[model samples]
Target: AVNLAIAFAMQGHENKVGLLDADLHGPCVPTMLGMQDQKLKVGPIGAFPALGPLGVKVVSMAFVLAGKEVPVVWRGPLKMRAIEQFLSEIAWGELDFLLIDLPPGTGDEPLSVLKLLPEMDGVIIVTIPSEVSQNVVGKAITFAKQLNVPVIGIVENMSGFVCPDCGKETHIFMKGGGKKIAQEYSVPFLGSIPLDPRVCEASDMGHPFIMEYSDSPASKAFMIIVKKIKAFISERQS
Candidate 1:
């Protein structure tokens, strides 16, 4: 959800936007956002102060835990409370969006996020091209609908492989599962992102592709996706 948050922020929404990484088991947003070093100071009333009122804010169970590398061994309620701390405790003044990135499945993390924010504006489902991913997301959509949350759109990440020298492309992750799913559910197909080597490089160097290489094709596509999100938000908010 860091991508979504940063993208929204880049689209000129200067207001505060918080990202809660409910994936306690696999928290990557902290490292991805280059906010790994700061100690997550959770207040007695659950207020985390570093994330300012109008800047981009992020919180995760991994950040709040003893150590990011240490295992978060806990049951359902325990996990739920941690999610609560990340949500209720954070001092997100006002937000254009609170992009909560749940782990890529219908597990405790996602369950906790849904239960925590039942009135979420919308969920932008991210997935690669595969039956496994699509099948699981069908369940996710059904569950989201069950909780009365809308499926805003589907983002097909790593949808194609970009050639290094010639600029050719290949749908290495199976096929157009995103389009099929979008068609099936009557949701918008936001955009497709080709797998670029630079994206991995940026991740390794601790920056997201959009910020690192804003002019790359993948970055441009990311910007377009952000535009789509902004349009969606504008239309919905109005």
Candidate 2:
């Protein structure tokens, strides 16, 4: 996966796109984008790669501490600096959308983002379609609401699976869990994605779902969600 989900994001628009991996604890975008071997240089000017796409840029802790399994193990201040470096020092280059993959939960990352960009467009929450997953996301939603950050919508991943033999729908994780949360929050329910083996297969092969299996239901779901995201954001900007 070339992270074209980030690429598809800029489709038909002449705007800038920034894919920020705020998941300090488990920053996987580097591995996901196949840029894990690349090193990032931090200079007095700022921290950024010397080469990449024009409008599309990525920054993540995975880039900073590449090939290392050491935990960040920092307090709020260190996390704050990392977030600051990502936003202020990095050459974001006039982004229209900064898709931040925040570390799960209502911890330092989300708080730092809220503090850094008080007028942020909003957050797109991701969760598996399960009661336990929804419960945890609900807590995050509560924190966001308390801090006054509107949730653009919820992206339901791993909603259900299809039986290859009989071609019947299986409620692997049960269904409608994401809609329940969206209804509770009064935010738009973007869409649901199935547990396609191709999704995991593509990721293992270093290809994102949108790239490998664009015709898959999961990819179709993402396309719809992307449109909803664009519309929701446009409304917010207006």
* TM-score, one value per model: 0.91, 0.89
Best by TM-score: 1
lDDT of 1: 0.76
lDDT digits (tens) for residues 1-238 of candidate 1: 6666776777777556777777878888777766676667756655673452236777766566677668877888988888887777677767777888888878887888887788777788888888878888788788788888778889988878878888778778878898899899888889887788887776666576677677877778788988887788678879
**Model 2 spans > 4 angstroms off:** 1-4, 13-15, 42-44, 49-55
Clashing pairs in 2: 1-206, 1-207, 1-208
**lDDT value, candidate 2, whole model:** 0.75
Off by over 4 Å in 1: 43-45, 49-54
For candidate 1, the per-residue lDDT at 182 reads: 87
**Alpha-carbon RMSD to native, per candidate:** 2.2, 2.5
